[model samples]
Structures are given as C-alpha cells and as structure tokens.
Target: MTDKVSEAEFLQGLIPQLRSEGYEVYLHPTAPVVPPFLADLRPDAIAIGKGKKLVIELVTSESTQQKKTRALANLIKEHPDWELRVLVVTSASRGNELQVQSREQIQNFLDEIKLLQDSNHVSAAFILGWATFEAIARRLMTATFEKPQTPGRIVQQLAQEGYVTPSEGDFLRILAAKRNALIHGNLHDLPQKGEVEFFREISERLAAESAAA
Candidate 1:
C-alpha cells in the first residue's frame, strides 16, 4: 500500500501514455522549490518530457483548493526547466479565475449550435450561443478592463470605450435585455437570428483582440 494510493493510481494510469510519447517519467521527484499548499498536501508527482518538467497534482472531485492550485501552477511556470508545466487532474469545477474559455472552445460551441440548428433546435442553440458569447465578453472585460457586476453594464462599458461599433453595441444591449427576460421566465424576448449572429461576430473580434494582447 502506498502512502497516497489514489495519486499513485492516477500516475499509474497516466504514465503509460507519457512513456508512449517518449518521456522519462519519475515518481515524486524532489523539487528545488515547493508550492505553498497545506503543509501536508504538496505536489503528487513530476514528469519530465519534451524538454520540460511537469508538476503533477492529482485532485479529487471534492477538492476546493483551486486558488492554491493556480498559484502553484503559476509558481511552477516562473521556475527553470527545459520548460515548465503544471498538470492538474481533477473532475470538479474550479474557480472563475480559471475559466477563460479558449477560441477552440468557442468554435466547438458554434459547431454544436450548427448541429442543433439542423435538428430544428434553433431557439435553444441561439440562447445557449448568447450565453456563451456573453461569458466570453464578461471574461474579456474583467481581464482587460474593470469588472462589471452585470452583463448589461459590461456591454455598455465596452461600448463606451469605443471597443464595439455603435450597431454592435446596440445589439448587445438588446441581447442583455433578452437575457434578463429569459432569466425572468420570458422566452419570447430571446434574441433573433441576426442579433445572435452579430453577437458571434463581435465575440470573435474580442477573442482575437484578447489573444493578440
């Protein structure tokens, strides 16, 4: 029986894949620096591959130490390795600080919408698409600008900064209204197809700008 059997089990399951990729895997290699977690719960293991050192943390579904996990990840990135990486394996929701949806994620969502649209689920797709777009917008605003308490305020602030065209800004305001209505149990106020498309276009632009920054 190992001291941390679950973590060992996780490494056992994953190491074969790392070896398949030609990495020299190690179990619990000692580090020059340790992340500040609870004194007892440090990194579970380490993997060296492709000229980088990966600090591995095996977390369960009930784990709640996300801020520390991220802090440790950032700390790992700041150090020297062939290159540095942190592998956090978990099956639970992390904090909002770690929830920036990537461009590929958004593209996958759009693809799903296309599939749903073909199945005559247009309204459902549109609603979900707007929610996703708004989430991106809110994340962008909070990261690059002041965080607003509400979606409408975030859109308005973006417009005020000349980040959005007047037409796009107006459309976003409409979507915010629709979101409010939807939350209040009114489906009739959902955005139209063209409006949702405009949100998509604006969201894509914002995402590109964020990446460039």
Candidate 2:
C-alpha cells in the first residue's frame, strides 16, 4: 500500500494543477451523487469545469472487472454531467513495466475522453499515472492559452480591462511557479500552501467572471 500522507499530498497538488487549467474541481470519498443503497462505490478524484465534469475512480486493491463495470455504470447515471474515467495508479516499483502499464492505461483513457468529447457528454477526460503528472500539467496549461497570446499576456490584458484584480495578478504568478516546478521536476521546491490557496482564489474570480459573462 502507498503511504496515505504521500497520497494525500499528491492529490493536494493535483487540485491546483487541474484548476490552473480551468477546471472546477471537487474531492469526494465516493461518487459525489449516487443512490444510497449502492455499497462499495468510490472515486479517488472528481472535477467539473469548462463544459465538462469528470469522475476518476482509482483502484488500489483487488477488484473484479465486473465490480468496476457496475460502479462505472452507476457513476455515469449519477453524474450525467461528468465523463467517467478510471485509473489504477499502482505502487509497482518495477520501472519499465510500470511505465508500460501506465502508458497503456493513459492511452485508453485518452481514447475514452475523445469519444466523450465527440459525443458532447463532456469536454474531455484523462486517466493519469504519477509519472505523467508533468506532461498532464504542461498540456493543460498549454491548452489554456492556445491563442496567439501567452497566459501572462492574457492576464495582463484582462487586468487592464478591469476584469482581474491585483491579487489575481499575484495568483497568476503562483501558477507560473507551479508550472516551473512541473517543467523542472522540482515540485518539492514549489510553494505548495500558497499555490493551492492562490489557485482557489483565482478560480473563484474566474468563475464569477464566467457567470457574469
């Protein structure tokens, strides 16, 4: 079993990463909404934002394919707004084999995301392993600023337009710090506490902006 503290810390970091990419995220011990009678229902992470919602059920113990299938079905029914994704982030210490397995899982998950996106059930979904963290962060942040303008530039423009606050400007800088950590593999050196708080603050501001728009 993986250390609970480490797992929690990892998930904590994941929240800001998703938020920086413009996702409204939530945490849950089980499917956020489901019929009360269904036992053994849980998902490690759940996030909703930007025209999409997602449920990520992480498998950490011995489980049957049938069980997983059933849970997935119930989850889909419960949160129709969410595109469902499953991941098994293993503690397999073997390097090459672990990498191969993770890649296969992620590819399959991406395929599902594409299918959902095409069907209009969700904007996208992704199943990720620990090693893919950096790649995922980079992709999400990159997607956020796909226009001809950089994120910093966009933020500055928005500030000039009175759409973002000076505090929001500082939050954007915090995002830059997180991005740097992702790119440099220095997550330990990243400002964990401030990054998360600032991310939430900026997300709230953006949500208000979106609502007003």
In model 2, state the lDDT of residue 52: 74
Q: Which candidate is the best by TM-score?
A: 1
TM-score of each: 0.47, 0.35
| Model 2 lDDT, residue 158, Cα | 55
Off by over 4 Å in 1: 1-98, 144-149
RMSD of each: 16.8, 15.0
lDDT of 2 by residue, 47-105 (tens): 76778766655443122343453446454755556566544344433322222223334
lDDT of 1: 0.55
Compared with the true structure, what per-residue lDDT tens digits does model 1 show for residues 1-213?
332565567678777876776777766655443333323345656666676665565433233444444445445434556222223233223323335556566555555444434433445445555645654665566565322236677777778878788888887777788867764457576566666566666776776775565
TM-score (C-alpha) between model 2 and the true structure: 0.35
